[model samples]
Target chain A: MHRIRCPFCGARDETEFAYRGDATKRRPPDDADEDAFFDYVYRRANPKDWHVEWWHHTGGCRRLVKVVRHTVTHEVHWTGWPDQPPSLPDGAP
Target chain B: MAITVRNGVACCLVLARRGFAEVTAERLELSLEPGRATIGAERCCLPIAPGEWLVLEQWRADGGLRMQLEGDAAGLAYVSDQSHGRQVIRVAGPAARDLLGRGCRLDLHPRKCRPGFCAATSIAEYACALVQVDAVPSFDLVVAAGYAESFWLWLTDHAAMFGYRAAIETVDRP
Candidate 1:
């Protein structure tokens, strides 16, 4: 099983987790019109190299984390917090 | 000394907390390494995926742990120090197997839920964290803290004829 580190609860088994969705994507400014904000929140392009978010220990600590993964290969290069960008190692798939 | 062959230790001092009671117990002298927490307890050397644990300290009517939880709920993680929200119930002294067998689906035989191992099972119509306290098949059940009074009454009322003499215990107790 893949072990993912959470910003709040440290590393936990993936079984106690749920994939939240793309992490790096941000919504438009809060001042933006309501319709535009709704579109930004709902619409998303399934990109190949995307940042995925995951929640660990749902019943316990309830913290979310991001994983830099390939959509096609389902391979994750690295994981980090929402504010931090995932770092890719050299020649990583 | 009772010899146990298992993955974790049956700590003499079990801390059982229920709903919002703030269950936080500091492991004494546990060695924390870079990525893992190691304990040289009598039963197991705990070092695996996570450093966290479902500590099985007994729940007492005396309120030693309850006072601690109420005093410092902010310092400990909400998962552990939820004494106000959950109930810490003790199921030990021989008939524990029979008491638990009526509810949980897990096998309480020494070959399965042996000393040092903890299981998350359903009891009292809700999910609970159950731990093996001894090889003879005693268990400590960590239930939601809100149900503490009801659970305590259940064990005392139902577990009497089955050979359980309701008594308070600590994790340090052997």
Candidate 2:
């Protein structure tokens, strides 16, 4: 059972949060070329190691949070507000 | 020994804009801090977020706390009268924590979540703002109006084991 410690609502069951896909993906500037926009919208890397993802605390604070987790082990390193930077996990490259 | 549910307390939600905490504090006459509540003579203000607070006061016949706050701090904060939008239920008794623990994930232990601690969490599938009101383990649950009836039913059903009573009182603001 995974429990996420929400910055606003404290620790809650993982079911309380909805996964919102990759947080590392940045949208291209409006003035950028169509190719850039296409890649930004469609192309995304599925890394095996530590990756940042978006999780919405739908049941609790109803706010979006950025979660850094290890894809292979399903170990969450840190969870923080989307606008804030997530702390790096120990021993992470 | 008994569980009591008190319904219809007046509540107000205050959302302070960026860099407006000082103004809010001055206007509301309560120091604001996340996860902590400042109880005054008339009302209690619980800072649920960095810039958000839930002000709880006794109900009155005339437009209660909402009107009072809007009249005082409408320019400094966004004041919404949640008296009707949400139903305030006070659960007090020796088994209050045990009853709440059936659905809530929060640690209701006096040491960890004593008086003045408020949180937004789920209670029996309904989103609720749970506030510890006193050391008697009394809790005030602010639930959405739409789910209030059903939530009350669920609570009463569970509280039957502990001997519960429902009371609807029109309390005057002090």
lDDT of 2 at A56: 88
The candidates' DockQ values read: 0.07, 0.54
- Model 1 residue A76 CA deviation in Å: 3.1
Clashes of each: 45, 0
Q: Model 1: per-residue lDDT, tens digit, A5-58?
A: 555434444565677775656778879898888777887767665445554445
For B1-174, candidate 2 gives per-residue lDDT tens digits of 343444546788888778897888777876565566776666778776656788888777445687888888877888888887888888888889888888887778778888888877788779888888788878888889899889988888888888877776555445
Mark the regions of model 1 whose C-alpha exceeds 4 Å error after superposition. Answer: A1-14, A34-36, A89-93, B1-57, B62-64, B72-174
Model 1 / residue B165 / CA error / Å: 16
Candidate 2 per-residue lDDT, tens place, A18-83, comes to 999999778888899999988888888888889888988887667888889888988888989888
Candidate 1 accuracy as lDDT: 0.49
